[model samples]
Target: MTWNWDQPDWPKFSYKSEALVPLEQQFLLQSGEFVGACKHMGADDQETLKIELISEEAVKTSEIEGKLLNRDSVQSSLRHQLGLGAERPGIDPAERGISEMMVDLYRNFGDSLDDATMFTWHRMLLSGDREIGAIGGYRTHAEPMQVVSGPDYKRSVHFEAPPASRMNDEMTRFIAWFNDTSPGGKTPLPPLTRAGIAHLYFVCIHPFEDGNGRIGRALAEKSLAQNLNRPSLIALAYTIERKRKDYYAALERNNKELEITAWLTYFASTILEAQRNTIARVDFFVAKAKFYETFRDQLNGRQEKVIARMFKEGIDGFKGGLSADNYITIGKTSRATATRDLQDLVEKGALTRTGELRHTRYHLSLAIQSTA
Candidate 1:
């Protein structure tokens, strides 16, 4: 049985233009909303949001490939790249490499995609790793490239990419199509939709021996950023990581077909979901700002620290709200002082008290509930 790449019309992908109309419309609207939200944020808040989003993207993208990275290390690397000042002592080379690659994509979103650019991205992706035999270039051998599952004796091959001999021509066509923006040359597809197609196409090519998936995702993000004419505003990797099973299923199901409507549809839906999540995060930040503004003058040192932690940690920051014991631990205060601080917050309307005595808990009274 031949794979899709072996078919006569192998690289020709088709989808009904009308089918994507709704998704395109929704994506534009949501993108506008997310951008608008970013504009309203104070500079500090905006910087914080950007760092958090990129950090999450870097970590989650790796997670999808079954590689776990330290979130702090990733965040620290990103912070250093963005000149935000790193709080951590040292960064792992792998973490630094991933951050550099992601930041490069974001920083150069408007530049045309080319082979040299892709080579640099691949190199950055595998910078610290000595285990992978090949890095910073295309696969040299024509070894059978199949994504399979189960034991060696009972494995199921989900997909097989074209032979390595085809990589140069295949990539040339893709890069040309990606960089083409002329109206008469080729009708430009919607940016978000184009990003989805780019992702599927690159992954199907499977040009690299390692990190094809990560590179494909990075390309998608770069395409989206170019389309929006801004830095990446949302982390699509987070949404993809959450629905990874469905994500792979979509790719596998579409691998054998000439018409990629199903894959495109799935991809569009994922973007919409990602946009909604981004909007929700923006709302939380806005609400947090408002909450702080409303009580900025009323908060004491310990109260300020605790409230900041609540916002930073979100739900996991404090389970069941802040108890007296929780406050003592977080605030580093004596029992009497913690009790007084909680009472003061309640009286000042900064927090609401529930339960009684040992069971009493203090919850932030701010109208905004964090989505974190």
Candidate 2:
């Protein structure tokens, strides 16, 4: 059960570069399309999108690590950090911390990766976390860093990272390799290949005592952004969160070997899926603008409030498709008014109604469907 870190080749990873060519091309095309699609978005839409995408990555990446954060709080923290919205008091520490890290990542996507940068991100990510013994630095404990599952009595060691004693050397090599493979470096790699390999290589090192997974995903995004010469505008963690099981399976399967074509292939496909998801989301933003333009003058205040609440839930609309009772609650109106307003929305083609009577539900007739 030796890991790749224990092999003679050690950090020198090998892969079938030719196999990733098609995916690389697809990623390039979709990235261009994604950027072009974003240009069509209105100023307000673009701002909403920037907050939405970054907060979504923060929330989803945390969720992947079994940390359930309030999405709204995270979004609020991000808005304040990005200077797009007013800073509200009593923000949760976890929310504020991750938001700061994400804002830093987004703002400095093209900066070189170094120990100072990694430490800054680490400190920002675990700002208020009290459980980790070593904050903002590499792990220094004597015990092994084993990624295990199941209860203590029947635990399974899925993967074990290099010991803390090798932290300085391992991290130095990792950083050098990361920079050397960047867009204009000594051994430049393509977008998806560099991103995929960067993610796997960093996670394998497992440099930090905590926040490795989140930081690893951030490195993947940064790699893409560097190659593309801008923020990649892809919801990588969002897409990976949906396919979490497959994501873990891919990493686990490749942990024992260095020829990581399978891992790269999986990651490339995931990047493509993420690109399509982001493009659809951008399209939805465009559709939303058009929707409001058409109905902005048509809806009353109550109807507008209900619609805004639904939009806040994101591309899926309201969770249960906005029932009459839900609308009444959101609109703060009586049953009759709720019914009338809902009917008006449907009649004007702003919403599509389904079910009937007590089982009735209404959904936005937006042009885009769920990315799932």
Candidate 3:
């Protein structure tokens, strides 16, 4: 559909490529990258990726659960309120690939990333993945084609997908333009804001079938990389999954009316939130790093294990931090053994008690990441 901005239902950003400029695009990217880079460092890169990927998958699952209630809030909201017990088989298998592919981008294209690389990432993102269906394996082989899930599966049909025959040329154009045009020729575009627009436009193009959402998300990550000059661990997907309701609704709203201001705001807000979340995660990791650095020699295997688990799980304070009961469960010891371990930990000064009796909780006597 050739977009006619005058139409009532047309999106707010209903203009062609000629309108948006390079200066604005570059500026957005540069600003977004600065914050993103600061938020991007810390943690063993591998462990960080693993934790973040799990977090994203958890968010994805929560969003799917949210979608069952309503597609609007389900897609747009970024907070995951669901407690444990949420699961989705449709998504489980794909999580590993998402994680692996993203990390691979860091390994393979960290220095030289761009649009074609983004397309290649999307290809890896969807390829051989049953969740995304047919669009999974190949670039568009034909034009005038409708993107649909298997006929048997009545989900995800993008009638807007370009004709199969034209897909190659269309994608080529998009990739080329994506690489070269920030505001097309002389007009500048900010990198930060460009990420938001590029993301929307890519999904608007709806180049694939079942994997559009996933691919769109990956595209967002790649955009961040280009903006920041490195792959970031913020898990913007996690933030979206957390706020699944608002995410879907915002996209739907934009897709139907072509008004992207709301979606752009949503995307920007999520990017900011993802950055904040990563900062929190990094802080937690930094604390863990300090704990090990400062007291590695003082801790025993059990203490080391306990501290590792606490940081890994982001546990702050606990009453009787490691109670006999928790020791029984986590340490796999009997009440007697658990009690003995707790007493030992207390004696070692690694743990301290609150109340004299059952009310007692344990905390680190020395600061985990204390400036003092």
Best by lDDT: 2
lDDT on C-alpha atoms for all candidate structures: 0.82, 0.90, 0.52
lDDT of 2 by residue, 1-372 (tens): 899999999877899889999999999888888888888877887988988888888999999999889888998999888887886777788889899999998899998889999998899889899899988899999899989999999999999999999999999998999999998899999999999989998998898889999999999999999999988768899999998999999999999998999999999999999999888888787888889998978999999999999888777677778899999899999999998999899999999999988989999888864353
Shift of residue 46 alpha carbon in model 2, Å: 1.9
Output the TM-score of candidate 2.
0.95
Candidate 1 residue-wise lDDT at 251: 93
Task: Count clashes in each candidate, considering only residues at least 3 apart in sequence or on different chains.
Answer: 0, 0, 65
lDDT of model 3, residue 52: 46
User: Model 3: per-residue lDDT, tens digit, 212-312?
Assistant: 56666655666666655655555576577667778767765665456455666667667766665655554455555555676768766665676555544
Ordered from best to worst lDDT, the candidate numbers read 2, 1, 3
| Alpha-carbon deviation at 131 in model 1, angstroms | 1.5
For candidate 2, give the lDDT. 0.90
| lDDT score at residue 330, model 3, on the 0-100 scale | 66
Candidate 1 lDDT over residue span 193-311, tens digit each: 68878899899999999899999999888888877777766769988998999999999988887688888889988988888777777777777778888887888888888888777
